[model samples]
Target: MFTEKGTLPDGIEYDGTLHSGYEIREQLVGDAISVFDDADVTARAVKNPQYLSVCVLANMLVSLGSIPKDKITGDLLMSMSQDNFNELRAAEERLDAKRKSFRAENKK
Candidate 1:
């Protein structure tokens, strides 16, 4: 696991530790394919764009300040202020880019 820390605009600190790359890929693919029993619902959910980002962030976020990982959810994240949510998204993007760069360099 790789962990990165940052503070949200609301002064809440977050841990964005990610699971293994393989696990993330599998989970995302599985969620995309099976989020709903009905194909129509799944298709609609997937088409939202924010749906995937929310799912990914929910999985990657280990904690918010004193909050435990198990208590974090997409609904909780969605309920945050727009600035906080955007900050979280930015943090996730930064961590993801860093991870990708590290992997690319290591493959050389």
Candidate 2:
């Protein structure tokens, strides 16, 4: 995993890691979605698509200050300050873009 360090609004340093698109898909489908019933998941997806981003962030975030990776959950992310949450979302986007660029340059 490739990790980049960033600072939160509160100045807490964290590491965000890049994940492959297939790994993200597996996280969403094989873990996040599979944990819930299909109908329930579908309703939640329709009502709160933003949660999918939370899941992806939780999956990619490697560390936050002293916080353990396993302790980083969607609820924990949601509980963060809006500025912090937005920073994290932006970090995820940056990491995703980097991963895509790397894949594009490496493709045979």
Candidate 3:
């Protein structure tokens, strides 16, 4: 299931933290099953370059407060379908609202 669809650009390379894209996808599953930390969560996504889509991954992470828009790559994101992209965006918005409400209460 693990295959290299392309090569990393000469100037760009990723740290080897996962054995397979499946590993990265599986990590995303874990994120849903296990509660994420209150802090940023994007560094924890599945880093697959093929079957796994980064846009879907980044948005999911954003929903969890794992990554901000600045952390995601637009090139990779372009590969994701509109439906999945929308879901992630919706999740991000919902979570952002949740966070804001929590913060607002603390000031009261």
lDDT of 2 by residue, 13-105 (tens): 335542221111112344465424456545655678686566556666666666666666565666666877777666656666777888999
Tell me the tens digit of each residue's lDDT in model 1 across 1-108. 456676666643345543221112212454444435556545655787776556556666665666666555555566666877777666656667877888999995
Candidate 2: worst-modelled 10 consecutive residues by lDDT: 18-27
What stretches of model 1 exceed 4 Å from their correct place?
11-49
lDDT of 2 at 51: 68
Q: What's the lDDT for residue 78 in model 3?
A: 52
> After superposing candidate 3, which stretches have Cα over 4 Å from the reference?
1-72
Per residue, candidate 3 scores C-alpha lDDT tens digits across 1-108 of: 111122112212123221111111112454343323322233343343332344344434432223233444434355445654555445445555666676788885
What TM-score does model 1 achieve against the real structure?
Answer: 0.60
TM-score of each: 0.60, 0.59, 0.35
Q: What is the lDDT of candidate 1?
A: 0.57
- Model 1 clashing residue pairs (backbone): none
Candidate 2 regions off by >4 Å?
Answer: 11-47
